[model samples]
Target: MSRTVAWTPEATETFDIIVELIETKWGFASAQKFVRTANQTILTLASHPEMFVTVKGQTIRRAFITKQTSLFYEITEQQIILLYFWDNRQEPIL
Candidate 1:
């Protein structure tokens, strides 16, 4: 069964920041493209919560939206909880 996907406040905030950075660095078209890709990835996660490999020794799974950006989430019984978006070049917080 497909599970629901819920975003944490941190996830929402990070997503906005990522879009803004993309828009500033690239353009509106690029930002829109990224948004579409992120939404599609989330939809895929809804049906396949474990599609991405989990963080070593942790329950959090990371899905790559782009080479530079990734979505982190945790799978629960009824849903996938989005934690935050990480810039892959930066040292991972988790």
Candidate 2:
């Protein structure tokens, strides 16, 4: 069976920010495209959770949403819990 996908609050907020940025920078159509692409990519995890290599740790995996962003998630037996949505274009907050 395919695992369910759940987005954390942080991930949802990050997604909102990116979509808003795209809408403001490009247009609603671009933002819709971005969301559709991202959702399709995210769904790929349900059937193949191990597609992406673990980046942050042994349990966490990342899947690219766009050229500049990726979604980080952890896989359990029944679901994939989305942890964060990272935007690569921004400066590292260090």
Q: Name the top TM-score candidate.
A: 1
Question: Across residues 1-94, which tens digit of lDDT does each residue of candidate 2 receive?
Answer: 6899998999899999999999999999999999999899888998899999887566888888888888889999999999888888877432
How does candidate 2 score on lDDT? 0.88
Q: lDDT of model 1 at residue 45?
A: 97
Q: Which ranges of candidate 1 are over 4 A from the true structure?
A: none
Local distance difference test, each candidate:
0.96, 0.88
> Candidate 1: RMSD over Cα atoms?
0.6
- Taking all chains together, the TM-score of candidate 1 against the true structure is 0.97
Angstrom error of the Cα, residue 15, model 2: value is 0.5
Most lDDT-accurate candidate: 1
Clashing pairs in 1: none
lDDT of 1 by residue, 1-85 (tens): 9999899999999999999999999999999999999999999999989899989969999999999999999999999999999
